[model samples]
Target: MTISSTPEGVSVQPRHIRFDVSDDLKSFWHGNNAFRTAFFNALSLQFPDGEQQFINAVRLYRDRIEDPKLQAEIRGFIGQEALHSREHKSYNEALKARGYDIDAIDERFARHMKWVANLPPSRQLAGTCGAEHYTAVLANAILRHPEWMEGATPAMACLWRWHAIEETEHKSVAFDVYRECVGDERLRRIVFLFVTWNFFKYTFLNTCSLLKTDGKLWSVKTWLGGLNFLWGKPGVIRKCLPDFLAYFRKGFHPWQHDNRRLLEKNLKELEAAPSAH
Candidate 1:
């Protein structure tokens, strides 16, 4: 992705996540697809409250931050999250229309964000940055997982793709802010590792929970499909893990990700299509 310097302090246009599914349940990996929806729906569910959490955390340690760039990045994060919430709200409604009570699942998410929001800025930033990394990994993972994603709703993949782009784009801003504000590598590292593990555990449970709500939990077919997508895809993990490890490879930051080209390239194609964008 080619990097363009934005007057607004280097930012990429937001990408939208759309859920794609098969026309027929018989033709698609319904459980996996539904589970993925819950995964992101969880994010959307948390968006408003999550931003509140960020706002509160930043306020809690407001005096610690002075960089205009960091401040701008925080605003960007809030804006992106707000947009995510709005979009996901619509998507969640779509799920509800399809007979799923997403808000029931959403309640737990709201509480979690509230808990995160109440933390100190340093810890808050560390936790958030860490979570974004997990998203980066998962997004890249989905792009790589062809079997699970194949016959996948163009809409669904696009949702994950758009989210992936943002995750890739903003992967390091939080860490940078945390490093600058708190200067606690050890704590940040621990938070990073712990948050990511939590991301997986919580996400898996939430995904499965929603699928069960939709009556599509844990079939061997879906489980196998999910595995096939993560492990079998070529150049997928290669593309993903590099970004993860790239953080520590020297002079890494948000701009270093520069996934703009990939996001734009994919978006150009995505926007033109009926299901993507």
Candidate 2:
């Protein structure tokens, strides 16, 4: 992927750090861990290919990247994304083993990506960046909403928790990369924010729909539990949203949150816990 902005201008480089997921929380799904299993299965099927497309979109001008620093950052970004997709693939297998409708989920998910990939560059950038905003927000919310995972099914909790940690950790890389690569900041922000709010609404609402479809809807215990655990907690939004919106401001940095502490804490615990089959 080519980054128009170099360190001479701007770009996203790789940072080494794996997120820690709590063993206790691994099993926590909204209701049934299998519901989450299915969701993940779907996500894994969609992401790698979609990521390639997104990468290709950036590659549209790979040779144009004149800045060595920015080029390295782009390589790092791609490497991390590749790692993420591979790890998720392993996780998705666990979901299928747990009896998720992985095939069905993948079929539909592939269709969506196909549609997304067909969109114009402007729209594609918006969707990708917008989705990043949601992930970034949700990631921070997960860390702040520790209580939300308190009683979740262990496997499911671990999955989302690990993903959240990584997302939060890498939150700004894509946006910053995009800003450095693409056109006017003002236009990017407008499209970015617009895609963001809409994607968020779609994701949560769709998650609800999926839960119901999978017969996990009545898991109100999990539902309300997640809410109270995450958004319901004091300072949940404060800890997260400001970071998200702060993107509009100069000198905003996701690293300021330093979620690695939480990841490390969880990893030690996972290391001690028995692995789930």
Candidate 3:
């Protein structure tokens, strides 16, 4: 795809970390809010399969890339996402052991990715770029707001934060691949619109499925609390609107937002923390 040069001061380094999720880890690991916790867990269910889709989408044009740095970043991006898929599978398995039906949710998501795999390569790459931007925006929010993961169990929090750090690190790889290979601005925007719709719709449906299985779907308190958490006070999703909309800018680049400092800080912390690789 031959991007002219990598984004200034931005590159991805893959980290392999082993997170030990406790046997007692509950489904409601985040602040004891079932809906909030379920929402994040639903997102987790998407990753094992979703990440493979991203990897395949980017690899379609890998040989076309001419820049050494971008090529290295692509490798790093693939490696990081591969590890994420593996660890999230373990995380989902832990949830399943807790009696949650996360494996069913993951299987359904895998079916969706299978459909995505059948699309044209350009369309597939565009979809990957769209989802990467979504992840980058959300990762930026998680890095910026400590309260988002407040009260989460230590192991669970470490896993989420680690994923966020690596997502931030490789946020632009797929977008740059699309820009360099497809160069279709209109198609990119249109695909993002579609991806936005499907992303939210599926996430909502998945969260509901999780909630239903956990016997919290009809809980008014759970709904109210979850709604408030996402759209009200702390407003993780609400506060991300600006960054999310920035994706549509004429020369939108993930590094333009420049949250690399957060990634750096996190890497340092994780390196110092006692953990197995």
Candidate 4:
């Protein structure tokens, strides 16, 4: 399949905004709901090392990409992901300071990523592309529906939305790079299946670990509520299934599921709320 370009009007620019996620940050910051808060915290824990993996995977093909525009996007992708890693590192530190065993969780992910680092460069890039699609799908949902952040702490809300906006903007960078360098559709599809499995496995395990630390792991009410939130009304993951599955299509491209309007609207809102960042 041919490489699909990032859509016009979508700019992969980095927003160097620092969030105030300090020690005083509440453990149940999402509407005082342990499940929701733990769910998001679980994601933050993965970003630092995960973002670096993405950066490294894309950088493998940097010199081979002769197109000036794609090269510029590579720089932008690396910059945005680097800043993401920094902010999430600080965010995760706050979680650790709050007495959660985030170090263990972080180390677990770090170990898995180390294994990924040893894979063939093309496989690594394919994994990056798969992970990017996952983020882009969830990012689009968060941007399209404001209620996802309804009860989140202001700073946390802004940080996540900013992340969502940028994820939407640069969703196609790694995919483009992979297409240009490898263009192995079968490999991309197969790797995406594995990525999907690990994504859910680790996210669930990490969320459970955080909840257990909070003494909410055995709370049936917490499990029921969190399960409902993800699979019942509003069904965030359920809603994303179609978009996630699209990656397996023969000629699929990240830009094919364009949501630039959502990106533009959320960006304007984010810019207006400078203090939120």
Candidate 5:
């Protein structure tokens, strides 16, 4: 894949930091609320295997990428994602210790990724680009709107914010690689639709599973509050709809959203926030 151009002025550096996700951490660590806690926990459950798949997909085309800048960014992307996988694994272990059956979900996700690995490399990389878009938009939402995480415990908040910061940093790496290698706009959009369906389907299912394990699945109040939190006032997912749809535009690029200021702003806050260490 010949290099076109990298995102201007964006540095993709990995931050090596650890968080205290010990067994003593509360099960309902996000605002002491079961619904919010399960939602974030479900995301944490997906990261370890999902990120490894991402790294592998990108690696398939790494040698073909002749552009030095894109090559450098790919290195940083892999480094950051490796750390994300490590940290989220620790976080998910805490959930498992709390009796959430995380192993079942991990096994299921592993099986699904095995299937994905059999697909053509273009499809795999396209899927990675799609997933990266989801993370980028969600990261932008969380960083741009602090209220989404307002009531979370400091340790958990720091971990997520740090993840968000890196997500924002390298959001365009996979897409740029995909463009340079495949450049199939139609295929990219089609695979993005498929990725979108599976992303929400699994996240919702996993959240429900966690809630069931917590004995809160059948609680009407839990569903009501969770739905409202997602779609009502200060709706985190709801507000991200526009950014998510932007991926489908004819000349869309991840950096088109241009959240560098937001990234820098929150990165500084994350650095100063002692809980992040």
Candidate 6:
């Protein structure tokens, strides 16, 4: 968690951290809560390919960025996301080993990204910007609220906490690239609208499929508990509403919300602790 000032002076240092996602990890890794666990598992299914899409989208404009610091941040962003894809791939494989169809979920996203690739580069990058904003806000929620990961196995917990810190570290890299290469504010906002709806739509489908596959979809109590986790007291989606809405402002930057306090506090906690045994 050491922060190094690069030659360009941006604080983005890609820490090549690794975690031990052992085969012993259960399918319902979140304290046996199938719905909660499937929600995170569904997210893991997206990272391997989704992260590569982020890298490719930003790399599209790598040659055009004139700012030295932003360039350095882009490199860091790519490196961090690459490791994230690798680690999440390993995590997904572990779930697949536990007899879940996570590979199908992973492939579904890959195919979807392939279709997205056919769009104009600006639109593709705008899609990446939209997704990055989601990750940044979601990461902020995890860091701000320890309860989100409260009952996970140590390895899964370490993996997510590490991802959240790095996501926050380089959250603005793709957006900056989009603004640099294609400063189409209207398109950016429009793409976000499309991406947001599609994101939640896919998330719900994937999560419900996972839940149904695991037999939790039939349980009224499971549905109630899951709903409470997402929309009840300390509701993460509710808490993130302001930040989410802030994205539509004519001129919006991720740092304007300024969750660095949470980042610093969590970074120290992570560095002070050992990885999952």
Q: What is the TM-score of each candidate against the true structure?
A: 0.71, 0.64, 0.94, 0.97, 0.97, 0.93
The 10-residue segment of model 3 with minimum total lDDT is 1-10
Residue 124 accuracy (lDDT) in model 6: 93
Over 57-86, each residue of candidate 5 has an lDDT whose tens digit, in order, gives 999999988888889999999999999999
Q: What is candidate 6's lDDT per residue for 106-144, written digit by digit as tens?
A: 677778889888888899999999999999999999988
**Which residue window of length 10 is worst by lDDT in model 4?**
20-29
Candidates ranked by lDDT: 4, 5, 3, 6, 1, 2
Rate residue 16 of model 4 by lDDT: 80
Show where candidate 6 strays beyond 4 Å: 1-10
| Predicted structure with the largest lDDT when compared to the true one | 4
lDDT of 2 by residue, 12-33 (tens): 4333434333232245344545
Once fitted onto the true fold, the runs of candidate 4 whose alpha carbons sit more than 4 angstroms away are 1-4
Where in model 2 is the C-alpha error above 4 Å?
A: 1-53, 141-148, 151-170, 218-223, 234-239, 247-277
**Native-referenced Cα lDDT, model 3:** 0.83
Q: Give the TM-score of candidate 5.
A: 0.97
The runs of at least 3 residues in candidate 1 whose Cα sits more than 4 Å from the true structure, single-residue gaps closed, are 1-10, 13-70, 140-149, 232-260, 274-277
TM-score, candidate 2, is 0.64
RMSD of each: 5.3, 5.9, 1.8, 1.6, 1.5, 3.5
Q: How far does residue 53 in candidate 3 sit from its true spot (Å)?
A: 0.2
